[model samples]
Target chain A: MIIGQIKDGIVLDHITAGKSPEIYQILCLDKLDCTIATIQNAESLKMGRKDIIKIGKVIDINFDVLGYIDPGITVNVIRDGKLAKRERLTLPERVTDIIKCKNPRCISSVEQELRQEFRLADRERKIYRCIYCDSEAKKQI
Target chain B: MRHLIDIQQLSREDISRLIETALDIIENPGRYSEVCRHKKLATLFFEPSTRTRLSFEAAMYELGGDVLGFSESNSSSAAKGESVSDTARTVGCYADIIAMRHPKEGAPLVASRTAGVPVINAGDGGHNHPTQTLADLLTIYREKGSFNNLTIGCCGDLKFGRTVHSLISAMSRYENVKFVLISPEELKVPKYIKTDVLEANNIPYIESTSLEDNIGKLDILYMTRVQRERFFNEADYLRLKDSYVLTPEKLKAAKADLSVMHPLPRVNEISVAVDDDPRACYFKQVLNGKYMRMALILKLLEVAV
Candidate 1:
């Protein structure tokens, strides 16, 4: 399978197998006018199989969402067909407007304008709790 | 700038100071009567609460501070679709401090961020009620003379009981404190509280269904009513509401020196016959709540004695 590289764009590499669709949906990649390609089940030495997403244009990405979804994924910035930056993500201590608090009794449920915020409650377990209700975020990913 | 959003926000030293101040208020009421002559407290209760709202109002009044604000959402601008932040900002302009109780969790936190004055979370859904923990602390301190080396048996609804969670969190900080959590299987304490709080602190605790079985070993028997408002299903509320009632028969197994406590507006979780059991300290807890609130109000206002 031959896929063309982009001159100025982002390559989300080393994503866990079968997780790019969620990343794409959450990041709202469909709204972007630029070309995007998702290469699934690619052979890798580090991980037996991995997913790669290639964005054809340089666009802002929410690293917190990426970190929360899969911290193992690597973000590479391509500028003038050269790897400008290679970045690794870690779980954010706090996240805002990324995930909604599902607790029905949460104040954010009724107040539409309030930013959905979560704090990393446990680092080892990758547990995030709603800032308002303290309800644990469901394991959607 | 300080707000009492969660009991965890308060350190052990802070709780000790608050308890000391509360005790001092109880001992020498006249000395602190006129401490806040010009200050105003706004009780912004977005939900119906008999004890907490009145307790804040009474606390402010006792300190020579005027009290204002609404009893429920209908009477306040919240009924007109005003956000908690807006209501808090508006209320902050009139009052020196705000004590808020809302049905939605973390409403007071939102208010605390926007309300220019300090905010006290009276109650926010089933999330937190720090002042109630203060009252409980004062009662426990007065009864047992210390928070250390005590066996606290929390009975009834441990799941949605914010007071129990707060009390557990507060008391767990002390030395040699143990807990006997008595609740139905469906109403057991949340897993995070057990794992994050109790286990994380190396605090020893046990879960049980029978109150009578564990009542004998307790230094303090904290009873909580299964709050109907917390339930989404009426059938579940009805089934669980009467799970553990503290009758005199059950009290017979309890220690003679056991301090029986409850956060009130209780609905038959405790029998009326047990009210005169001499060890019943629920009424005292109510009075202690006012003193604690007064102390808290003074603390937040930076009022020096």
Candidate 2:
């Protein structure tokens, strides 16, 4: 399927197959006043299978949350249909208010409107733990 | 100014400083007395807590400070549908600092986020009891004189024991600290504790069901209650309840100088007969708890300004 190349936009390439919609939801592409194209389960030699998202306008994207989702995803910026700059995502050292802690006794469970914060406890295993209780987070990202 | 929601937030230096302060308070009580003369400590215990709630009040009173707040949720505005955030904000206005004990995990964190004053987690659900860990650390430091190079055995209810989890997390930061996780298979220490705190830090540890078999190898034996409340089924609690009772005979295999500690309100886990043994330090552990809370209160209050 040919999603037309963008002149000045961002190409979120190399996303793990079947994970683009979640990213699109998180990035809120539905609310954006620009063209966004998502190609699912596309052929890729590097990843075996991949998903791609093409945004027709330049917008600030949260690299931290993106990296937390899939560290290998590439964000390719295009200017006038030519590659301008390329960036690769990596897991964030910490994520805030994105994941709720599962521990029943965790402080976040009772405190309304508190930022559910998590810090990367183990980089190698991609483990993130609640900042308040240190309980392992249920969030895969 | 920061709230201590978990023992994991404290570093080795922080732990050392707290321990030294506690020791100083132990040695020279009069010198630090009246440090919080004008301050107030609010004990917002949403759940029933006998030792923790009282010692926090005692710690403040001993520091020449006043203590206020309810001992249970029904007495507090929480019964009127007041959220923890609102309670914390309201309490923040009246108290210099707060020590909260709630049945819900992270209730203290919510309070800490909303309160203008510092918040200390006395006990939050079964998630954390840092002051208890502080008490445990002070006991270990006073008895053994160091945090490193020791074999610590934690027995009973490892799965639901917040005290054990916090203790393991705190001790894992020290060098050459090996752990013997003693519990029935059903009550084994949670897998995340082994994988995240132990293996992640490369701390050597062993898990077993029998306490007597590992008694001789330990420098410290931390006992905890096999709480009936933590068990879902009464039959499961009864079956695993008597699995590792520390009897006088068990003490025969333990080192003479072993620092036997327990976060009290124990039920049959440690025999009353074993209390006469020189190794039993649970009572002293209680007293040490007061000193550590005093030290912690002083540190947090002084920094709050």
Candidate 3:
């Protein structure tokens, strides 16, 4: 059963289970004044398992952060308890100002004060590359 | 431009512009010093590549920029089981731009996605080395005065040398080029390269195990180290490692103007006796690398910021 509802906010659907912490971090939800419900490990007839993040207020989505966390997450804007707009946040052509390059020797990673930037060249392959240090966003732990 | 993940994103016009910028830096070093002044470059090297690491730092320093980041993997938080993405998110808060080198394939690509700053791939496992290829292009342009219609003979470990593979892919795009792949039977150029690059494009080429036999007919002699570790048996390695060395006697057979190039950090592939020869361009290659790097830093920073 659909438990209750959000009056006015954004609903992030189709998130992988147990990824709310990262999604929360990506959206900077903790720092904001809003209600966030992260549902993980739920049974779905369509999807074997699913996750969702329901926000109580409308916040301008940070697409770079969203794309990085899970390229598959979709953000839906709810207005007056009606779905105003729902679309998958396509990865940007060039991702800028959302992530810090982890290449310890990368010029951006080494210099403590400098802000790291990477361009999202391809979304399907989930490839993001650094402009200065030439480091790529590697998903491998 | 947040990340420079692949060379495919760059058009030929882009590469030409970069080379032109590099040439400008070589001609006037003082003009571009402050271009990146006060900016910091973070270098995250998870692997040990002394030459590449130093070359990158030198590039940033020459631009009046400061350098930060680690040279070793052990010193970083990654040792404690921090994920590459999480580490990148944290590091992104600190650095303006980042360069990463990891032993794992596609590590840089992963870091690039998570980084807020510009990312440069120094070397990611053996998948791609675009910057080194850029340096090679700059070196060829500066040394040969052009990038067209010339024979490039790559000798040594063709199968494993990342430099050789990148150069071949880059050079194959040029006009009127032929390749002389010189390596032992045990260390032939990979079949994929020959099929995908040479024959597919109909670029004329020949392969041989004897460097001396092919030395006289080439315009460029590219040497790569034939490591003992690549061989299964010690006797075979001992037998073939010395077979391809460029000796003074071998140079006698080469053309008077035949240029000899090595990717560097040489380990007896090219004799010390050949160092004094005018044909040896490896030392010049090193300096050219610095100049080219200076050019790259200037161009990338200018375009992005």
Candidate 4:
């Protein structure tokens, strides 16, 4: 499988297998005019199989979403066909407008304009709870 | 700038100071009277709460402060599609402090962020009711004289009982405090509370289904009504509502010095006959609630006596 390199873009690598589609949807990649390629279950030395997402343009990405979805994923910034920056993501302490609170009794449910926010309650367990209701955030890929 | 959202927001020293202030208020009421001569408190109850609303109003009045705001959402701007932040911002303009009770969890937190003044969470769904914990703390302090080395048994709906959760979180900070959680299988305390709070703090606690069995060992037995409002299904509410009832027969097994406490407006979880048993401190808890609220109001307003 031959894929062309990008002059100035982002390469999301080392994503957990079978998580690229959800990331694509969350990032709203379909709305972008630039080209985007997603590779699934690619062979890797570190991970047996991993997913990768390549963007043909350097677009603003919500790092919180990526960190929350898969903290182990690596984000590489490509500028002028060279790797400008290689950064690893860790779980964010706080996230806003990324995930909605599922608790029916949460204030965010009725308040449409309210920003959905969550705080990392347990680091080891990767648990995020709604800031308003303290209800655990439902698993979102 | 300070708001009472969760019980955990207060440190052990802070709780101690609040308790001390509450006790002082009880001892010397005349000294603290008129401390807030011209201040105003807004009780913005988006939900129907007869006790908490009145308690805040009474607390403010006792401190020589005027009280304002609505009893329900219909009477307030919230009925006109006003958000909590809007209502809070509007209310904060009129009042020096705001005490809010909303059916949606974390509504007060929203209000606290934009209210511009101190906001006290009266109750927010089944999430948090820190003032009630303060009331319970005062009641416990008055009865036992100390928070340490007490076997506190929390009975009834431990699952949705915000008061029990707050009390446990508050009391767990003290030395040698133990908890005996009594509830039906369906209404047991949440695992996060057990692990994050009790276990994380190295606090020893036991869970039991029988209230009668655990009643004997408790220094303070906090009873909570299985709230019908918390249930989504009527059938589940009916089945679990009668899971535990505190009768005089059950009290016979309890310690002589045991303090029987409830949050109030209970629907037969406790027999009326047990009210005169001298162990019933729920009424005292109600009285203590006002004093605690007064102390809290003063603390938030930065008032000195």
In terms of DockQ, the best-performing candidate is 4
* Chain A TM-score relative to the true structure, per candidate: 0.90, 0.90, 0.79, 0.91
Q: Give DockQ for candidates 1 onward, in order.
A: 0.72, 0.60, 0.03, 0.75
Worst 10 residues of 1 chain B by lDDT: B71-80
Kindly list the per-residue Cα lDDT of model 1 for residues A1-141, writing each as its tens digit: 999989999999999999999999988999999999999999999999999999999898889989989989899999999999999988989989877888989999987499999999989988899989999988744
The positional error of residue B166 in candidate 4, measured at the CA in angstroms, is: 1.3
Candidate 2 lDDT over residue span B89-132, tens digit each: 99999999999998877788778877999999998776788999
What is the TM-score of each predicted model, taking all chains together? 0.95, 0.91, 0.65, 0.95
Residue B22, model 1, lDDT: 88
Predicted model 4 interface RMSD: 0.9
Better of 3 and 4 by TM-score: 4
Candidate 2 lands at a TM-score of 0.91
Q: Rank the candidates by DockQ, best first.
A: 4, 1, 2, 3
Docking class of 3: incorrect
lDDT of 4 by residue, A1-141 (tens): 999999999999999999999899988999999989999999999999999999999988889989999999999999999999998999999999888889899999998599999999899989888989888888865
Model 4 segments more than 4 A misplaced: A1-5, A33-35
Record all residue pairs in model 1 with backbone atoms less than 3 Å apart, i.e. clashing: none
